[model samples]
Each structure stands twice: as structure tokens, then as C-alpha cells.
Target: MGDQKGEVVGGLLDSVRDVAGLPECRGICKIMYGNLVRRIKLLSPLFEELKDGRQELGEEELKGLELLKRAFNSAKVVLISVNQGSKLYQAFHWDKVALKFHQVTEQIEEALSQVPYEKFDIPQEVREQIELVHAQFKRAKLKVETGDIQLMMDLNVAQIEGVDPAVLKRLSKKLQLMTINDQNKEGRAIHELAIASGNHGDKIFEMSSLLRKFKDCTHQDSLEFDSDEGERSPLKHRSPVIPDDFRCPISLELMKDPVIVSTGQTYERSSIQKWLAAGHHTCPKTQQTLLQTTLTPNYVLKSLITLWCDSNGVELPKKQGSCQSKKPGRESGAVDCDRTAIDVLLKKLADGKPDQQRAAAGELRLLAKRNADNRICIADAGAIPLLVELLSSSDPRTQEHAVTALLNLSINESNKGKIVNAGAIPDIVDVLKKGSMEARENAAATLFSLSVIDENKVAIGAAGAIPALVSLLDEGSPRGKKDAATAIFNLSIYQGNKARAIKAGIIGPVMGLLRDAGGGMVDEALAILAILANHAEGKAAIGLARPIPILVEVARTGSPRNRENAASVLWSLCSGDLEQLKEAREIGAEDILKELLECGTDRAKRKAGTLLELFQRLDAPSPSSLEQKSDA
Candidate 1:
């Protein structure tokens, strides 16, 4: 217990210096950090005094030391998190950050109160200073600054108004997101934060999405916000409050093709389609048990919606099929033609026997594949979990169709979250391990789609998917190898998953794919290797695989992307290792690198340039040799 207390005191002192040394912050963080650093500095002398008297302290003082350690640690985390997070994220989440400050300050004051400072033989000035600081902290109230609120409002306005240059320019400058380069740096930072956050929640993902909008806005070459083909308006950002009667209850957008369920509740065709497809036997609005699954078209509601749109200047939701001659631009009522048929198929999926289930799954797979809107309709109807459940069916054909349907549905960004949240990773991994070749291949593809979201990477890796993916990479058919390679590459982006991939024995198959140039997985294999090389364990494993000669060869002769990756992997291996550098020199890689300096892509050239400099250092005379020469 004494040793632990000493360690905590030592850590707290170091953290104090770290917080003090941090650069000046802007906005809400500036105020919070200023107050915190000032208060924590007052504890420095108190902490030093404790270190000297720790052996003589009583039990109450020791408990107070533990509480002090926790308070300081919480302060350090809050300060660092605000300093390191995306500046825009800090501004937008000012309320949360302010609450953190309040909580951390209260914690410090409470810890101070518990400590019997008078018992220790501390200097009179220091003790009074500590007490005064504690009193100030106890009285301090953290409030969200008006500037931060305006900054958040500006961000929302820019997002809603479709890339207002003035708004973006002002907000970007304020948020320090001025250039495309700055945006990229913040993007990488957010990705790191997301991985570090683990399964904490959606906050990091929201930061990523907000940053993406800033990138899009800044990347535009012109001032005009194109609403038709470029920078299309998001539905939520539209200014008008859609009438309650005109909006679909499930989707809350203007109902293009409104239909009434048995409980007399109206919904957009796609929304209702999604709800029914999910196998719900009750009305979504009232939760009343559905008497029958029949959907009656509300033509009067549709006419009213059209009149409202005309009066309000809001365009009605467009149709998705072949244009009708009578309406000129409007789609023929092909969706109406399929509505009854889809209703029957959804019933078969929910209540039909095994044969019917198999047939229905196959058709839904085709429908989801045919159009993006159909995918939305299917997913919103809650078909994703049903499809995930079918992945475990005893019938082989049913399992194949079910997994394939999920793979198709996973293409939609919203459906990706739904699929993952529905507890699909373990089942998908099971399918990848034991299902038929096609099912396994589609399962791999589905995993890739789901892993597109950063948080899903952690969940998928934890579900024991890496080993099965490696097995597929080693033995599956050509298409299967490609799918597995993509999923593995994406999953390995998170740091933990990178180590998992290495431990799963991925190096052997990756080397095999690299050597078999005609196997058509060279691009995929190289991409995965580049990501894995970023990890320390992965670097050691790839180095032991004796890949220097192959990497050098690819850097010399492969396609642009492959050459870039080869250079990256080589640099990672040879950066600090003298043995790898010596091997590269002996393999005659110098001449190829010099040629790359003149003709390669920007990134490839950068990596090649770095390697050449390392080679120069390898040949450069050491300081000791220079000293010996002077003596001679």
C-alpha cells in the first residue's frame, strides 16, 4: 500500500508538468484548461510535501492521497481529450466538455477537503495557498460560452445550407480546419480517437461525419451549392416542417406512395414495406395487433400531398422505376404492381415453411440487388435481423440466400449499423466457417461492408472473425480470397485488430499471394500488408517472412498502387533495423529507388525518398569514425 501510494504521487506530479506544458487552447477548452492548470499547480508543492512525509502520514492522509490521485487523473484526461480531439467536435460538444470540467473540479475540491493538511508540517504559505485554491475550485461554476454556441450554430447552418463558403470559411478558421491538409490531419486524429474509444458510443462516429462534411465543403472549387447533381440536400436539413398528415409515420418524410395498414395507419410504401418485412404483426404507430396484412392505397392522401408540395414549393419524393408516358417524368406505378407480390413474399419469409422461406429469401436477394430504393424499403421494413436469423438455417439454399441478402442490404450506410447492432458478427463468422462456398464468400463481403464503420471493427474483431477470415484467405476460391482480403484489410485498420490479424497467422497466406503474381490478389494483399506493417508486431512478423526481395521487386516493377504499398512496407521494415537496410542494399534496391524519385506518384516518391536517405545514413561515416580520423 505504501509503494502504491508513492507511485500515484509520482504519476500525479508528472501529469501536473504535462498539463502545464500543454500549448494554449482556444474556445471552451481554453477557459477550462486555464482554470485547471492554475489549480493543479497549487497542488505541486502540496504533492511534493506529501512525497517527503508519505512514510510518516496517517491512514486518513493516505486515503486522501488516493482520492487526490483519482481527481488529478480525471483532470489530466479531460484536458488531454479536449486538446487532442477535433476542434470542431470540442465546440459542438461544448456542453459535455463543460460538464466534465465542473465534475473534475468538484472532484478535486472534494479530495482536498478530505486531506488533513494541517497535520503535516508543510510551510504556512503553501498550506494557505492550497486551501484558497480548493475554495476557489469549489466555488467555480462552468458555463458553456456564447462563442462556442455560435460556433456550433455556424457548423449546423453550413451543414444545412449546403456548403456556404462564408460560413465554412469562418467556422473552419475558428475551428482551425482551414485547409484540406488540416481536414485530413483532423480526420486521422478522429479515426485514432474512434479506435481508442472502443464501444463507448456514437460520439466519435458523429465527429467523423461532421469532419467529412467540412472536407466536402472545402474541397469544392466553386461557390455555388449545387442541389441537383452535386451536394444534394439531406432530408433532415430541409427547412420546411412537413405536415403531420402528409408525412409517413415510420419515415416522417413526405409520403410518395402512401398506403394504409389494417390498423388504419398510413406510411410511405418503402417504410411500410420495411416494417412488414421485419415480421412485425402489430401496427408500428399504435402497437395495435394487425388484423390483416392488407395495405390499401390512400389516393386521397396522395393527392393532398401533391397539392401541399405545389403550394409549399417542396418537391414530392421522386419515383424509382420506368417513366410513365402520361406524367412525362414520373415513374410508372411499377412499385404498386410489386407491392402485393412483396407483401406475399414477406409473409412467406415470416410464416411460411422451409421451402417457402428458401424461395422468398432468393427473390428478396434479387430485389435488394436490383435498386437502391428497394434496399431501403427492405431494410426499413426490418428485414435485416430476419435475414441475419436465416443465416443459421438448416437448409443450405436458405442460408445462402439469407447471407447474400444481408450482403446486398449492407450496401446501404444506414443498414450497416442495423445489421451490426442486430448481433450479426458471430453468426456471420459461423457462416464464414461452415456454410457453403457461396455463403462463405457473401458472408466475408458482408463483414467488409459492416466494418466500414469504425466501431464495428472492434466488435467484429472481438467476435472471433479474424481466424475464420484468415482461413478463407488461405483456402477459398479466387473470389472468396478477394472478399476475405478486403474484409481483413478493413478490420485490421483498428490497432487491436491489426495484432489479431497477425496472431491469426495471416503472414503466410499474404506472402503466398504476393509470390503468386498471377493470382490477381496482389493489389488486395499489398494493401493489407501496408496497413498491417503500421503495427509493431505486424512489422516483426512481415520482416521474419523474408519479404525484402519481393517488396523490392514490386517497388521496381508492379503497378502504381502496388509499388506504393511495397515501398511503404519496405520503409516500415527498414526504418530502424540495420539488418533490413543492409539486406536491401545488397539486393540492389538503391538504383530502383533513385529512378522512383524521378517518376513515381507523390506518396510513392515520398516513401522512396525516405528509404534513399536511410541508405545514405547507412553509408555515412559515424561520429566515432570522424573523431578517430581527426586523431589520426
Candidate 2:
């Protein structure tokens, strides 16, 4: 029992010695044996006493060792007294202040470092706040590192708490001095982060995109608002008015190719002027303002009137006021002479001077050829009868010019019967048989124009014009041959004249002219042959004489125009006679017919097809024979 008590007493002594050695207090102490020792003067002694079976310590015995252990273990109670005592010591000594601050900084850093960085999913606003906080923390850290205590103090605790760990690490120096306001901390942080990341420019671009979106949104809103307003909005309620017959009522499309009518209204050319003049210009459906302008006669109407006057052999209005000024100058004179030549010509005509009359008439004929209007005026002024009389003259030039002038006057179909009645055809034919190339060509052209009318064709054919034209084909000039061929072609278009042409022995010469110097003559001759081939008398004449060789040559080696005409002739021949089918096939007509059928004009193709069909039908075997062969 004494040994255990002694052991407990020794343990209590060691605990008291350990507590006394702790540096809980600061003081001057003796340096004994190179070790500084604090002098802790004990005011009480150790003693032994009994109280409720607990031992009481006696004076000067160091009996409070167990109580010291208990107090030290109860740090909350003992730390308050220690802090109070340290504050009192610190008031008297500034050296301990630095050490206290160092300890405080170490504690704060350790606590901040322990904060969990990865625990929370940061909202955008919270993330921004953290960025701002980090920026502030960096600034504060920089200032604190440079020993700017005032700046460090200015930084708030909230700023440090809000700082994102990543941002805090990135800009630790700037973040160190920043203050965070709880109210606007997130916004400020976002702004700071945006500035640091150079996203401010991107924000401006985003603002522009937002403005555009706003504009589109506003437009849509306005439309909806307008629609909601219903009829109150004029723009929403009103529709553009258009006419029922909005078309030009002329062209029936929009108003183009406009012309005026006598009813004082503008309409497109497709509108009938006469119908408009008769008060039919307005739209049948809508009586809106379809009138575009005031009316005037179209130029074509005047042209048609002029054409009518010229065609009927009527004289145009003479330039009366100043004949000399209005008359073409001597340099522009077609006759290569003056009015003196006319006087001389009139004298020769009166005196019956054949050679002189012929020369003067030839001059007039040359002038007339140069001016068609002059020829018409001369004919209308009764020069035609005088020229017809000159056709009986012995001089060929006299007869030639006389016939030429007469031919010019006879161009009008209305004048054709009259010219024939006046014995003009025989005179013209006589001159054509002996006339110069120019005279013959002019005669042929005039005859051709006249032959367009069926009455003129009969009159001319009756007056023996076919033989004279055919004679010109044999001995005429290139132009003469062409004109003669053309006239013959025109004559053949009339079935009555076709028989007459054949009876006049004109068919052979007309076919011969197909190989003439002029390509036009060849085309015209082929055309005449084609026309003749359509008539029974003409076909009989062609079949007996057979112009097929000439036509075949033209088809094979002629110009496209010639080939076309040749094809037309072949078509007419095949249409008139099935016997010509074998002949056509023998001439390699099948291949040529196919080419024309595919590539020729519509008319040519139609004719070629007809010919091909005719050939096929003619070549087809009898059904009775086929049936018999099948039965066998």
C-alpha cells in the first residue's frame, strides 16, 4: 500500500513539472546551463487532508497538480483566462503582436484550404460570383504579399467564401483584395469573369443578334396586332382593285403594240380598228377606263389605202404647188435627161418616126422602171393607148418600151380586162417575142402580178400570153427567164390556165427553163410544172413528154429551193398518176422523198407523205391473192 501511494505521488509530481514547463506565459528568465528557465513562483504549498474521502493538499506541497491537469484538459475554461492574460501582456509588449498575427494567418490558410472545391454544381450566377470572388482574392493576395495591410483589411470575408476554387487558383493575387456584396456578388463576379475571359466582345455580338431577333419579334407582333384590330386597320381590310377585263381588249394580253381607232380610243393592234370605230372598244364585262389614249388612224391603214390606189392603177395626188421644186432634180432624174426629152418623145410619137420614137420611148421606159409611181401616173394619164399603138412599130426598141409601159399600166387587175380589150396582150406578146431582156423581164413581172387575180389569168391566157412567156423562157435574159418562169408558174395555179398553157405548147419550154442560168427560174419552172401536174390536160402533156428527167436532176443536184420545188413537182405528178410511182422509185425517189418528209417545210412534208402513201397503196398486193396463197 505504501509503494502504490509513493508511485501515485511520483506520477503527480511529474505531471506538475510538465505543466510548469509549458510556454503558456512569457517572461524574463535566468539562463542557467545554456537553457533559459522561467521562474514560476508558487504562492501555495502542498498538504494532505481528508474531505468526503478525497485527500486535501497541504501548504507548500505542490498539491494542485491534479487540478492543473483537469483544468488543462478543460481547454474552453482555461483558454479564456490564457487569452485574457495574453491580451494584458500584448498591451505592454509589441514584440508578441507579430507572432500572434502569424499564427492567425496560418490558421485561416489551413481552414480555407480545407474547404471542399468539388461538392456543389455551380449555377451560372453562382459560378460568376465565384469568378468575381476569385478575382478579388487574387488582388487581396497580391496586396497582402506586398504587406498592404489596409488593402487586405478592405477585402471582405464574403468575397473569399464566394470565390470559386478554380478562379481563386487562377487569379489568386487579384482575388485577395476584392470585396463581395451578397446582394450583387453573382453579377459582379460574372462581369469580372467576362472581362478576364475577353467575352465582353462576344456579349456585344450577342446583343446585336438579340436586336435582330427583337426586330423580327416586333414585326410579328405588329402583324398579329393589326390582324386583331380587324377591319379597323385600313391596310388589313383594303384590297387592290383590278378591272374585270384588265386585258388590253386588243392583244388580250397587257396593252402592247398599241394603235388608235377612229372612235378616239387606244387599243393594241390585235383589236379590230373598224370594230372599235363602230363603238365596240369598251370591255364587254367591265366598263372601267380601258381607254388608253385618243384615237388616230394607224399607219398600216394608210398603207393599205395607198396599196389599193396603186393596185387599181389610180393616180396619186400630184405635187402641184411648185412642180419644179417638188420634181426630182435633173441629177435625180431617172431618164438621165430632162422634160425636153418628153417633148421630143411626144413629137416622135406624133410624126411616126420609128427609130426616133423607139429611142425616146426607150428613155421613158428606163425612167418608168426607175420610178414605179411615174409609170402609174403615165398610164393613168392616157399614155397606155399611145404606147399600145407604138407596139405596132417596126423598131424593136419602140415596140419593147411601148410594151414595157403598157405592162406597167396593166399591173392593176382592174386594168387587166381593159388592157386586154384594148388589144394590149397581143401587142405585149409581140414585143415580148422581140423585146430587149429588160423589157421582157418587166413584162413578165407585170403579167405575174396581174395573174394573181383569176379574172386577169383568164384574160391574159385568152390573149395568148402563155406562148409569148414560154418564148421568153427560151431566148430571154436571166432576169427575163426568171420573170417568165414566175409568170408561167402563176398562170398554172389556175386550172383553166394550166390547160391553156399546155395547149399553147408552153409546158416543154417551161420545163426546159428549169435548167436556166437563174436559180429562181429553175424554182419557178418546177413550181409551174408542179401546178400543171395537178391538171389532167397538164398531166397528160407532162406524161407524154415526161419532164421527169429534168425534175430528177434538180432534186439530186439543185439548191435547196430548187430541190423543194422539184419535190413539189414530184408530189403533184404522183398525185395525178399511180403509173409515175414505179418511175419515181426507179429514180431513187424513195430516199429523197423520205428526206423531204422529215426535213422539208410543212407543205413539202405533207406532199411527200401523200406521195409515199400513194406509192405504198399502189405497191400493196391484192387481198384475194394473199388469201389464195394462204389456202394453198
Candidate 3:
């Protein structure tokens, strides 16, 4: 009989742990079940107290354990139900879920009250914890959270009254559903709930209606947004992408009347007005509280947008609520405009005179830098071949503009392949070696951007860009050195390029930067060394530079990220190299390791802990010494 009671208590403890291990509920469901989860987790330690002493329990205590087990089983059901339910459904039907919480709380409280502590072998701490949990459940049973009730009422009103934006702003804040990512998560939950409910209910209908209204007020509509002209124009296929800066951050549509808010972020006048009317006292784009809510007209951006529209043949959007606005799909004029502009520039590069080529290259550079869409447009217009041709032009300024344009265009991921396939690496390398300083800086930067593609790392290395990059790092201007450091860091990520970089004499410049405390390149230098330290030859070169004291100083005093990277580099240096480990210990790295173990970033703390353990292990007597001590 005692054995059976022990087995029962052990099984109940397992059940309690399982309930405590369930994932906590989220959003409105979290508000309802959060306290209940806490209560169940508190009971885990209480059950643990009974695991070894289960045989000492009498029948009455066994009955109490059984009662608590039943209550915990009930809790597990409720937790699973809420975690799997739709956030929207939970928000709308919060009262029904709250009832489940109230009932489960009462059941658990009653079951805990029956556990006679004096009759059992449980500790005083476990008894007190269970009692505290019982009292909490007792209070929770009668407590009605007025705020949760109000939130539920707001959600219902939104479902019935077509979503007042002011109420929506309040709901969004209360529910933590502010970002687009949050809305998408709720949408997925709603879809899952609809599928589970077989899609035929008033509740699903209400949820769908509320979500639709919420999205319509928040997200951008299609190109036909506010325009009433519904005709499908033939030019719909050629509608140009609007520049992101010209569009309202709120509505994501072209701003007819741009206004600057207190935060200096610009938005369309109507969109800002609607946001203010919705009782939002903060900027939509920045979320900063408004100082005065004054809308100052941004004449400069308005003029630039107007000039762009005029040059691209795109129609300017009309004032809010005005008739005769630009028709949707018919305003594909910008598309045609960009195509024409790019073709004319390409033609100038191919056959125009020297001045025309330089001017055209400069224009293409600005166009590529303006926005992502323009980068695509410029590259799609077949400008890479012409630009590569100009990389070696005898005219220095034209070469500068040409390489810089390629640099800007390479910001788009797809254009990396295009630039490489156009046979630009050798020309870019040539410019890096011999062009004017600014041109060489940009050429190095261009190589860095292109080398982001892993395959280009090898090609750029084979084309001898590493030597030129090393030279720039050693002798170029401040900006040039930074660019070269970044390019070398990226190229050296490949196994083959690490050797090439070492052969090109990268260690001297890197060591110089490390030793120069005021050079502002310590971060970049240490970052590159951290990567290079993993390679054998590169590691040997860095080791010969005698980097322990400097690295220890950095680990002791650098900024958080710098300290983290310094720790990483130190660990790489000392991991398999006993001489390096002894050198670090001798140079006072042990005290810094202890400091880092306490206050460093997570990765830094981990590396510091491993190094500290290694140091301790080294300090401990060996097995042979221990045996000798025993003999003595």
C-alpha cells in the first residue's frame, strides 16, 4: 500500500511539471492566464518536496495529492486551449475565457486547502509557497480586471460600429499590436482559427470584418488608392515605381502636400491630419510624442518632388478631396520617362564626346544613388558595360564617376552578378592601384560592395585586388583606409583569400592600427584580426606581431562590442597554442577574464569563462604531481 502511494505521488509530480512546462499564453490570452501560469509554476517546487518523502504520506495526504493532480490536469487543458486559440477570438470573447480561469483558480485553491501540511513531511518553505499560491487563486477568483473588460468592449465596438480609428489606436497600444509584423501574426492566427472552426460562424465573420477595417486604415492601398478614375489604361504595364522619400510614410502614397512634423519627419498633409484626428499624439513614422502638433509646410521636398514628376512625365497627385486627380494606370508616364532618360545616358556613354560622357556618368551615379528602384532601372538599361568601359578612360573625372556609379548600382543584390559578368573586376582593380585618391577610394569601396557575393571574393582576389586594397589600407586617407579594411575583411572570409591577404602584407597595417590608440580604426582592425586569427598562416603572422598585451588592454577597456570582438580574437589565439595562453596569463589576462566573465556580453562571457577554466586547469597539479605528493 505504501509503494502504491509513493508511485501515485511521483506520477502526480510529473503531471504538475508538465503543466508548468507549457508555453505561456500571448496577447489577451496572456492577460487572462498569466497569474494561473505563475500559480502552477509555484507548485512545481512544492511537488518536488514530496518526491523523496512520498512513502511517509498517509491516505488523507494521498487523497490531497490526487485532488491537486486533478486540478493541475484541468489547468493543462485550459493552457493548451488558450495557447492554440486565435488572439482575435480571445480578445472578442474574453469573458468566456475569463470564466474558465476563474473556475480553474477556485478548483486549484480548494484542492490546495485540503493538503494538511502538519500530517505530511513537506518543508516549511514548500508549505508556505503552496499557501501563497492558494491565497492568490482565492483572490483571483473574485477579482474582475476592469481594464481587460474595457479592452474587450473596445474590440466588440470596433466589430459592430465599423472600427473608429481613435478606438483602434487605443486598442493597438493596449494589445501590443502596433507594427505590421504584429498584424500579420494576428492575421495568421485568425486564418488558423477560421480553418479550425470550419469557416461558418458569426464569430469568424466579426473577426474578419474587424481585421479588414484595421488593415484598411493602416496599410497602403494599390496604385488606384484615392483616384476615382477606374479605367484600365493600356500603360498600366509600364507604371514606374515611386521614390520612397516622395511617399507619405503613413499611407505609402505620393504626397501632394508634404508637411514636416515636430520630429522633422515629413508626411502628406491629409495623412498627418487623419493620424492627429484619430487622437494619436505621436508621429506615425517615428512614434515620438509630438511637441506641439504643428504641421510646417516642407517647400523644399515639395519642389524636388515636383521637379522629379515633371522630368519623368509623371502626373503630380492632387490636393486631398479634389476632383480631376491623376488617373491610375494611366500615370505610367514615369516608366517611359525613366526608360528614355537611361537610354539617352547610355547613348552618351557609347558615342558622345568626352564632356557628354562625363556628364552622363555623373547623372547615372546620382540616379543609381537615389533609390533602389532607380538602381534596378539603371542596371536594367544595360549601363554596366558602358561604365566598365569608362573605368580605364584617360579622363580621370570620368573614370571616377563611372566606378562610383557601379559602386552605387551594386547596392542592389541582383546587380552584383551583372557587374561581375560585365568583366569589371580587372578594370576596378586597375583603378584601385593607379587612379586618383578619391577614385581609388571609390574603386576600393566598389570592390567591397561586389565582394559581398561569395563567388566574387575569389574572382576579386584572383584579379589582384588584395594587394591594392592592402596598399590603400596602409597609405590611403582615413575614409580610404576604412573602405579598404572592410573590403579585406569581407574577402578574407573565404579560405583562399585569407592566404592571399596575408601574402599581400596585411599584418603590418593591421598591427599599426591596433597600436595607434587615437587612429579611430581599432574597431575595424580588431574585427579583421578576429576573422583572420582562425586561419593558420594568418594566425601565425598575428602571433609574431606580439598582440597579447594590446588585446588584453582592449578586453579590459574597449566598448562593449569592441571588448566582445577582442575576447573572440584572444580566444582564437590561445585556444590550441600553449605559448599564447602562457603569454596572456603572464600579461595579466586572468584578472580581465574574471571581469569579462561578470560584465561582458553573452558571447564574451562564454569565451572568458572557457579561458578562465583553462587557466585554472593549468594552475591545478597534474596527475603525476598528485601521485608524487601522495608518495611524499
TM-score of each: 0.49, 0.43, 0.49
Residue 468: error of model 1 in Å? 0.4
Clashing pairs in 1: 274-380, 274-381, 275-381
- Badly placed stretches (over 4 Å) of model 3 are 1-337
Residue 115, candidate 2: alpha-carbon lDDT: 29
lDDT of each: 0.78, 0.50, 0.78
Candidate 2 has its poorest 10 consecutive residues by lDDT at 28-37
Per-residue CA lDDT of candidate 2, range 423-522, in tens?
Answer: 6766666566667677666677667656655666777777777888887877777767777776777676667778778887877777666655454455
Compute the lDDT for candidate 1.
0.78
Worst 10-residue lDDT window for candidate 1 reads: 192-201
Q: Write the per-residue lDDT of candidate 3 for residues 13-132, one digit (tens) a residue.
A: 777677667775555656557778777778777667777664477778878877887787677777776765456777777777778887888898888888776666777888887778
Mind sharing the TM-score for model 3?
0.49
Ranking by lDDT: 3, 1, 2
Instruction: Single out the weakest 10-residue window by summed lDDT for candidate 3.
Output: 192-201
For candidate 1, the per-residue lDDT at 193 reads 37
Error of 3 at 41 (Å): 78
